[model samples]
Target chain A: MEQKETCFAKRVRCIVKLGGAAITSKHKLETIDEENLKEVSSHLRQAFVPDSTSANVLGMDWSRRPGQSEAPSFVDDFSDQPAGDSESFIVVHGAGSFGHFQASMSGVHKGGLSRPLVKAGFVATRISVTSLNLEIVRALAREGIPSIGMSPFSCGWSTCQRNMTKADISMVIKAIDYGFIPVLHGDAVLDTLQECTILSGDVIIRHLAAELKPEFVVFLTDVLGVYDRPPAEPGAVLIQEIAVREDGSWSVVKPKLEDTSKPVEFTVAAHDTTGGMVTKITEAAMIAKLGIDVYITKAATEHSVKALSGILKGGIPDDWLGTAIRYMS
Target chain B: MEQKETCFAKRVRCIVKLGGAAITSKHKLETIDEENLKEVSSHLRQAFVPDSTSANVLGMDWSRRPGQSEAPSFVDDFSDQPAGDSESFIVVHGAGSFGHFQASMSGVHKGGLSRPLVKAGFVATRISVTSLNLEIVRALAREGIPSIGMSPFSCGWSTCQRNMTKADISMVIKAIDYGFIPVLHGDAVLDTLQECTILSGDVIIRHLAAELKPEFVVFLTDVLGVYDRPPAEPGAVLIQEIAVREDGSWSVVKPKLEDTSKPVEFTVAAHDTTGGMVTKITEAAMIAKLGIDVYITKAATEHSVKALSGILKGGIPDDWLGTAIRYMS
Candidate 1:
């Protein structure tokens, strides 16, 4: 079938996850960080080039007719750089203000769909998350990224324990093969045991990283990266590199948990139903176990964008910019 | 699992369809008939009461306590009307100017997803349809209908011949059981052989009618009803009733192919990728064979709204208003 052929044709090469705090105002309900979103979207657009070799071949043939200097292909002047031969990307975004407030109110993140009391919260969460997805898609479009928004809840089924047993990723694959970025966000999904639960974007990114086998998985967050001490502490030090051990444990620089002198102010927003920094690190560790390089960087920072560009080009970015987690066999 | 219990808990009791031309300006690209849509939405909200017996029981006990004249059971009065016990509904809408133009341009209705040239059209069609769904949901909310939009593409799968083999109606049933109207629309769906294809709302309505045994299935369209001749023709007579035979064939009056004297100007809109009036009648007949009453009525007309109210109350409307199709055996 054409569907299978298309899926095999384009092997996904990259995954960029935009954190909720990075693109939306986490503390303020329903407020989007429009400036940061646009800036990050523009950087993302420049990072990946949609492959157009099939059309280019025809253009080359037409230009070679009789005796004439080669006519530049239509995209020659339009594109800022040459098209990436095998670059394809998928973007996963977290649900900040759109879903968090309602979800927390209903305890949906803790699998509260069985209670009739959570009904209003469920409806509001779905509508708000979708509303934000529309905005995210529009921002990406403004930057010339042919981005299409996808709903995780609508496409995936979870077990009673919130284990996703099945997910229809065919559409996502088809979109990528057609040179469109499939944009996904955190959503309220139906679960067999729980009735319904919040499926975070972090978990989705891990699933996608395994399915797509992308060379690099990037997580654009609010802070710089993982740190030896609490990020808010006066003398906290950034941990630039994290390595996965043979036993699947992470080996990153960290301060002892028993150190009472350390000030840990890793704030989880009031309405955030899902866990904050802890969840991100755990998901990143899982992805790192797959032998994929996972970069955690701050959005709207020049150094972060530069590091992202470097990763897109398949090179080592500046070490001091962000933390990179990888497997060491 | 809770999901299985919820699925079997609620049996769908009604279905109301809003036609593309009724809510959208079919001739204009992406232009919505806001006034008609709002009017129709208000009527739809009044027509069905979500089953709230389970929640009402809890609320009644709480309101009986001393010093409390009444407990605002949250949704009490917040809802447009008293929740209709054992009354639940699912709404299917057509993809008007939003999707039809792109679907036709790419010939998706004829299975065009196999070709790479139509890829852009495929993505565009999906986005446009969802955009329209957002508007529809917002309109429903304005009328206090707890409506949630579901994309068929994200929730269903079709075969090579465009037959929907798998559609997750469990979520729909669950939504109704929890007091929400699941709004579905025509969308670009994944296909086994074709890669992707357009699933018309007419086909979806028939599928839902068979799955969910609703008492009355209403089709809100731009015309009054089906007629012996084209409604625009001089001296044309509206057919009040149609009966389906034992063999599942229609007993209504139909025109012969050789009748050249007829004007035959049943205009299918320029961008309409699906079949026109003929298809609607065919689909309605199919639903009739399932032993359900199918009413075709004008959306904006006061008479049609009154007829809808009558049907909702399980009674006969005044005089001849809209055409009702049913089965005898």
Candidate 2:
């Protein structure tokens, strides 16, 4: 095991969160957004070469496409670098529509194992989320990425009153050291206080970031980025950047909007048992306070790729259109 | 959590091992023996009602099939019992051809994560086995049985020098208490001494038996029962019964076989990364020594169902034609 650990450094390059709504049809139960999944996988393949020795064999063109000026130029030079230097990142995805229905119907998140309906729901929810996890892993595998689906609940992750109490990530660490990307997802887990509860992807990433301390974190959602109000609102505007202080407080940094007095509010989808956008921002802020920048952007877009690869190449590009949350200097 | 523990009771009723060869097409990569799986699941449903209250709703016919005189008579009265009286059992299935190909090709069982091929094989093997697990779970679920797929490796199971050192079965216990059948399978897990190793379903059942202490165990195989020699060999005779003693020694209990001196010998399949038939008997003998009787019988057969339901009701039927290993009284 020690010898194997030396093959790939233990350092995690970054953590990517593929929001459920971005990769799956949130309104349709268990429906995957195939096109978005494929595009995201293709972009990931472009960003990270699997093996340094096989770099020449792939012969992939990493140049920016026509009319996509916002795409970072760093990606164009990605293929030129040695594959051995390829960055390894972890992927965390939302359950989206796959499990939310069953979870909500059974009230699994509320956690009452004594109820037969709740128990049945817990089983059904796991089946749905794990099925989606497999789909994501398969898509990544098709792109020559060795993605292993690691469900949080099955990996001995549990909570006490909805707070994570146990999270065994040794296998996760071993997987990264062995050159495999561990793809995790929101899952229904046993809770000491509630009997069973939903562990959201946002919470999973926060826990991971605290332990692995990745260089940066990327959250790919259905919308462009965080908005002052729900994206559907008429006056909703994307909050370009936010900075978190040591005291866990955050403020909008970019755009310098006049309405800084009001708190950013987001709505949770009816079927989403786990807290939705609000949870993502809360977790991101926690991560930002740890000195790790977190970027929020839409999946399968040039801006998303730019945020992902630009950070891998050392800094986020100026043209990137995403919400960047960083520690206040 | 403590309040919920009083729901179903923590005591396990039984543990069932579904042989890979019995449930899958061993020659076909990743192909499920759908008919066999469905039949076995149907038999399981007939043997155990999911919920006591829903027993009336199911209105299942638990009688012996026509012309199946060997089928135990006790099953005819199963439906007359209260639904709450239904026994709970755990299912453990093998990878069969699904993961064996990948495991053998990558030599993942030999363990060397430092080698890229080995690591890739580990990932592929996991994907194959877990996929089969999902299929089995779905089959059981379709039968109205709450089956949860619990991949050993992903659930924090590992071996040190090929000996299981970490197997957190808290979730399994919780699932059972919640009235769900926790389905586990052979998996590729991190090994402290070897970097990684294959944990066979046989070993998993043995470990589980030691922990859960179920009343009895049933091993479902493709063949009728254990033989003195390979079942396919000429003049091979099924050993009807075996008695295990405190010293970990076992001997033929019935049929008064002429050749008592010779040890039972079985061959391993080419693609089998884990010890096959040999491991099954070895583990069975150990469990028998613990005072728990174990039955090995052909799957999807009336005799198999007899062994299962008969034992659940009280004792094995005298007409059963499977090999029974029990502690010497």
lDDT of 1 by residue, A1-329 (tens): 01122254687777888888888887766778999997887677656644432223211011111243332233222333323432588889987666777677556666654354454556667777887887787676545455667787665445456776656576677667656678888887766676677888888888888777888888898888776555666766666667776676766533234453443333212112333656777788889898888888888787566656654236444454677777878
What is each candidate's DockQ, to 2 decimals? 0.13, 0.16
> Highest TM-score among the candidates is held by which one?
2
Candidate 1 root-mean-square deviation in Å: 9.3
Candidate 2 lDDT over A1-329, as tens digits, reads 01111233578878999999999987665778999998998777776654423233221111123455221222222232223524689999998877877787668899877665566567667877888898888777656576788888777688898988878677788777767788999998888898899999989899889888888899999888877666666776677888899999888877677666665432223212342566777889999999998999989999988877756335545677778888986
- Across residues B94-132, which tens digit of lDDT does each residue of candidate 1 receive? 976677776775566666443433444565567678878
C-alpha lDDT (0 to 100) for residue A168 of candidate 1: 54
Enumerate clash totals for all models, in the order shown.
1, 2
At residue B139, give the lDDT of candidate 1: 71
Highest DockQ against the true fold, candidate: 2
How far off is each candidate at the interface, as Cα RMSD in Å?
A: 13.2, 13.0
Worst 10 residues of 1 chain A by lDDT: A57-66
